[model samples]
Target: MAEGEEVKNKQVLFRNYIDGFPKESDMYISTGNTIRLKLPQGSNGVLVKNLVLSCDPFMLFLMRKSDDSGLFGCYTPDSPITGYGVAKILDSGNPKFQKGDLVWGMPGITACAGFYVVSTPKKGETVFVSAASGGVGQLVGQLAKYFPEGIDIYFENVGGKMLNAAILNMRNHGRFSAFDYLVHYSQFYDILLPFIREGKIVYIEDVTEGLEKTPAALVGLFSGRNIGKQMIVVSRE
Candidate 1:
């Protein structure tokens, strides 16, 4: 396609701020949009086509109507839903990125920032990580294992009364932690890519093809329908 050409831009629109668990009916696939294959003058944006869309539980928080987290803001109604994703840039106004570059704005420095950085962790210290099989927790646990001297893990998913109990036991002036406070995607990828190449890290994908199927894929996440990381394959071009 020419640099100034436009192509149909398909999207998954959030129906509205949701109630309870989400259903396939909560999102709508839009096909009426078009994207120009060129960058706007003086813009710092990179125009790209989505390739892989990650589906994680945190997305549900943004789907709620009363969010005040100010971390990841709410997904607007009648507009595209948001999450981490890999895309191939078709146009660029940012010198740090260029056309045809397959870039991803995404994941898992969470455990490092939360447990290792904010919370104190030491070599040989036994650690408890919740959601040990999910994305961040799994990596956290794995990273714990990678410590050269070895670290013991007490992995479990604690919630409800257990969560309250844990909170109640917190020491006064205990440190609280937050991730994504300052995002450096390049740093994240730099850390991950080496581990990936060395086989020290691996990714699990529960992939669904096409933009239209994204809703069902998201809804199925509640029921644990997919294995590994749930993602939608929007394009492989």
Candidate 2:
């Protein structure tokens, strides 16, 4: 295929603005769209073919209608819902990325960095990380291993009872680092590079194949039905 050629794009669309917990019905797959295979002229964007789409809890907040107080805008009805994903670049106008480059990160958002600055874990200090099994939580747990004391950090994804228990177990002057799903941490890659290269972290993914299963994959995150990081496989290659 020639570069810049247009092709049919199967997309997962957000049906409407959600108020409470989002259901599978809140999203739908649409096949009537097509996109250019190349980036726009003078644009610095990279065109990617999504291979895996992450279903995260933070997406629930983006499903809501944009309010004055919210920092991230809501997903538009009848448009493709966006999130972090693993993708293969098809074409690129961006200098940093090139065709066939495999990448994963949230689009249009600053790459998460600076976790080391705020929550520098001290050796032997007890740390408690909420949502430990989820995507972010899983990383936090693995990263905690870098501290002189391993497994001292209490990590779990479920809230409510878990939060209460974590708090009750807090030691004197225990520093609590609260992670907001909406906030992206700077220096994220910098902190994880060594761990990733060393294979110190193991990633568990709950993958649902096809765009049609995207809605269910996302909804499963809320019901605790997914065993690991929930994701939808849009394409294998």
Candidate 3:
């Protein structure tokens, strides 16, 4: 940044709730730059200049009006949207922040917004973030490494190919467990399923989108446990 450069504003708009897979038509873009540079005096809020933004599948859940209240219910029609964004303070009302300080949080848009008004807190140590390469993932990962204990992760980061190799090498009768949010169905079938059978791997499946494809992908992994079938929809509205 240079001295005396004019600041610009951007707004992201919702294109309407989408069905099945999302496409470019599912979102709209709005242009604007006159964001308030400060919060009103006596108000406990901070005005931020946003930095990085993230796009994640969880965002899809927020788009539907019929979604559960756990989703973003306060979002109104026609308002410029918000989400997770890293920002620098343009002004603040709390002692935790000052002008030009960098901060990160759950932006109004959940992890994709341009600016957010929220309390600034100092997050503590040794955080393990999933999808460390992604926008939000990367931020948390970097923040972890910044701490005193500092990102003492068992595994730093792994790509698809490397992860596949690791699973394939597991000993027979080995068990592997992962969170439901880890990967999408298309990816699991194409990558993890084969390794499960080849490594005689025992695991569980909780992801839903791959339900229809489960039988086939499982058949390919014949050695894994075939019973105790549970298809729990952990949080589907």
Candidate 4:
């Protein structure tokens, strides 16, 4: 360490373990646990300079104490919060990555300090993001547009006329999914069931608020939430 040099980090910290549903009060933000410019010589990792952090609904589910399914256990209470983000690399011992490279991926808790860390976004296929302007929605929207065929592919929003337009413009044999921003069960079932039942849609995907609440997530999809691909943001972000 040199004189006048300083190390500081700002992070979201958990205040306590949560059970059941959580509110904003369940967490807090603090400044601490920063790192130096250099890491261990033999360590195989990249030190990232974060630019953006993605706050997602799924991050909420991970806050649960018993995610033996290998989900929530990754998070701990009263610790520096970690989630996916987009970042630039500042240093690396890993051959696959180099400083100055941009990537969007998950950075393990404390994996990189100073700047936020993330993996490179995945490649391939068209992605339709609902509420595309939202925190998580924005990242997905950009990715869909950047995909090789983004220009040719349609990026649809899932509300009012947007949903109708997306469904109408979809390529034949193409798969369609959705992100449920509104937690309404009846509207989905009563409003969209006809289109789905008629094969106007190939498939659907969603992350809702429950297991017992699954019925509602699928209420509009027919058959009480058809069973191809379904999920919900079961945690707090």
For every candidate, C-alpha RMSD to the true structure in Å: 5.9, 5.8, 19.1, 17.4
Instruction: Give the TM-score of each candidate.
Output: 0.74, 0.77, 0.42, 0.43
Each model's lDDT: 0.69, 0.69, 0.41, 0.47
* RMSD (Cα, Å) of model 2: 5.8
Clash pairs (backbone) in predicted model 1 = none
lDDT of 1 by residue, 91-188 (tens): 88889998889986555666544554456655646454544444443454344244433334332243534233334444444344434435554565
Worst 10 residues of 1 by lDDT: 149-158
Candidate 3 lDDT, 40-82, residue by residue in tens: 7697887766554433334445555664734455344455545
lDDT of 2 by residue, 44-92 (tens): 8878888988887778878887674245477889888887889999988
Candidate 4, residue 99: how far the Cα is off, in Å:
1.1
lDDT of 4 at 30: 64
User: So what's the TM-score on candidate 1?
Assistant: 0.74
Give candidate 2's whole-model lDDT: 0.69
Whole-model lDDT, candidate 3? 0.41
- Per-residue CA lDDT of candidate 4, range 105-210, in tens? 4321221111111211235545454443333333443443454343223333334444554455455555543322323444445544586588774643444542
Give me the candidate number with maximum TM-score: 2
